[model samples]
Target: RSNKRLVPNIVEPKIRTIEETVPMADRTMEEILQEPTKGYGEAIVILEILAENFEIKTNLLQLVQTNKFHGFERDNPHTHISNFKRMATTLKYRDVPNDAIKLMLFLYSIEGAARIWYEKKPPNSILTWDDLVNKFVNQFFPPSKTTHLKNEISRFTQRFEDTSGEAWEHFKEMLRACPHHGFSELNQIDTFYNGLNEQDQDSLNAAAGGNLLSKTTREALKIIEKNHKFVIQEANRMFLG
Candidate 1:
C-alpha cells in the first residue's frame, strides 16, 4: 500500500553572480554558446496550505476522524465542510494564526481520491479557507448533480397518498441538497403549484382566498406554509385518539 516518494532531492549548478546574471541579449558570444543546464522548471509544487505554521491540538485528530471523506459519489462536500467548521470552533490551539488551524486540519479530514485531489492543487493557489472550500465543493458536488437535482425540483409533484405537508417537505429537501439550483422563489412556487393535482390546487386557491397568483410572492408562500403547518398539527393530534 506504500507509494514511492513523489519528490526526489535536487543537485544543481547555480553560481550566477550579479555579473553572470546579465540579460541573454546582453551576453557575449561565449556566454550565449553555453548549454542550458537546468532543463525545465518544476511542474509540481508542495502545498501552501502545509507551508504555514500550525500546531494541531490533540482533539483535532479525533474530530477529523469522525468526519473523514473517502471520495465516494454519495459523499457530501458541503455537509462535510459545515461539520468540519463546527468541529474546528471547539479546537483550542494557542498562538496559531487565524485560518491556519482549519487549513492544516482539513488535510487529515480526507483520504483516497479526495486527499490526492487536494495534494495536486497548485502551490499557493489556495490562499484562504474560503478558497479551499469553494474548490472542494465544486470538485465533489459537480455541475451534473446540480442539474439533476434542479430537474427534480422543476418536476416536483405531490404523491397520490402523501399529504400536502409531506409533499412540501419533500420538495424542500430536494432544494436543500442542491443549494445552487438557481431557481428563484417565484419559479419554485409556480412549478410546485402547476405540479399539484387539481384537487390540491383548488384547495390551495380556496385557502389563498380564490386566487393564489393574485397574492405577492411572500404572501403565496406564507399561505402554502400555513397549510403545511396546519396539516402537521392535525396529524400530530391524531395520536391523542
Candidate 2:
C-alpha cells in the first residue's frame, strides 16, 4: 500500500540572515510557554535546545527560571513547583538566577488562586523569593510527595519498545519532582542511561565509543535515536526477506 502512494515533497528550510535570526532567548515569554506540548518535561528539553543553539552565556538555572514562561495559573501549584525544580537542576554547576528578576518574573507568571497572595502583599512589607518559594512548596510539594517522587525516579526503567527520547523524558519528569540536590552530573547521566531499554543502552554505548558518561545527555540521546532508526530499518529488511 505504501509503495503505491505518492512520495511527499521534501520542503527545504528557508535560509535566513543574521538580522532575521531570532534566537530562542529573544522569544516572548508567552511564546516559550506555548512551545512545550508535553508539559514541564518537554519545556525543559526545549530550553536546553534553545540554550545550545543560541550559545547562551547566562547561567542556565537563571535563564530558565528568570524567563517566567509558564502557561498556567496559581491553582496549578504543582506545575509552578515543578518549573522551579526543573530550573534548579542547573544550580549544581554553581549558577543562579538574579533574585529580583526571578521574583518579578515569577510574580507576573502567577494566575488563578495563586494571584491573591501576590496581589494582597502588604504595601510596605518585604518578601524574598525564598519566602514565596517556601509558601508554594509547603502548599504543593510537601515532604511526603517529594520522597515519593524520588522513589519513582529510582524505580524508573524504560520499556523495551520505548524510544530513547520517551524514556529520557519520563526520567526528566521524575527528576523535576525529586530532590536532586547534591546529585553529580556523572551520576545523573549514568542513571538516565541505565534506565533505557537494554537495546537502546547498547546502541548508545556503541555510538559514543565508550565513556558515554563524559558525553552530554543531549548528544547521547541523538546518537541513541539514530542507532534505533538503523535497527528498525535492519529489522524491516529481515522481515521482508
Candidate 3:
C-alpha cells in the first residue's frame, strides 16, 4: 500500500445543486395547482359494460381457452371474432345482458399489441359487439388481404393434378374466403367453367351432354355436381369392380 493516497479519478453522478440550475418560477398555491402535474396514467379500455344489479359473473379461464390474439397480419381477425362469439355464448350466465358478458370477457381474450390497442381505445367509445368487431377487423385485416382474396377468386385456375371435383371445391373455397367478391352467381359459374383446362372442360362438357356454359345457373350447378359424381363413380367402378 503506497501512502501516495490513491484517489478515484471518477466524477460521481449528481443531483443539480440549487445554485447550478434555474429556479422554477415562484409559484403561488393557485398557480401550482393550475400547473399540470405529471401523473401515473392508467390506460383505459373503450368498452362500456352497463352494470346491472347482481350481474352474472363471467369465467376468465373459459374465455382464455380460445387462445390469445397478438394482432399479427397472418392471423384472421374475423375468424377469431367469430370463434370468440361462439365461446362466449357457450357460457351460461343468468339475467345479464349478453353483450355485457361479451364486452367484459373480450378484453381478457387478447394479448400483446392487441391488448395494447384495446387499452388505447377511448373510454365509452365502443358500446356494442358490432363496434368492437368492426374496429378489430379493420385494424388486423388489411384491405390488401381483401384485394388478394378477390384476385385469387377472379384468377382461379385448375391445378395440373386436381380432379374436376377438387377444382370445383377449390373454387367454392375462394368464394367462402371472400364472400363479398362482387361476382354474381352467373359470373361465378362462368368464371369456374372458363378456369378449367381443356381436358377438364371436355370432361364437364361430356358429362353435361353439351356446352355446359349454355345452361342456366341452376342447371350449370347441377351439371357441375353431376360431373363430379360421375367422375367418382367411374373411378370407383374401374378401381373396385
In model 1, where do residues sit more than 4 Å from their true spots? Answer: 1-54, 90-97, 119-127
Clash pairs, candidate 2, are 74-111
Q: State the lDDT of candidate 1 residue by residue for 123-213, as single tens digits.
A: 3356567788889999999888888888889989888887888888888888888888899989988987887888878888999999887
**lDDT tens digits, residues 94-168, model 2?**
232344334423543444455544434432233455666776656455677666666676667886766666676
Of candidates 2 and 1, the better by lDDT: 1
- Identify the candidate with maximal lDDT: 1
Error of 1 at 211 (Å): 1.8
Candidate 1: pairs in clash: none
Model 3's TM-score against the true structure: 0.65
How far residue 147's Cα lies from its native spot in candidate 1, in Å, is 1.6
- Give me the displacement of residue 89 in model 2, in angstroms: 21
Order of models, best lDDT first = 1, 3, 2
TM-score of each: 0.68, 0.42, 0.65
lDDT, each prediction: 0.69, 0.49, 0.65
lDDT of 3 by residue, 162-204 (tens): 8888899889988876645789989998899899999889877
Which pairs of residues collide in model 3?
Answer: none
Candidate 2 TM-score versus the reference:
0.42
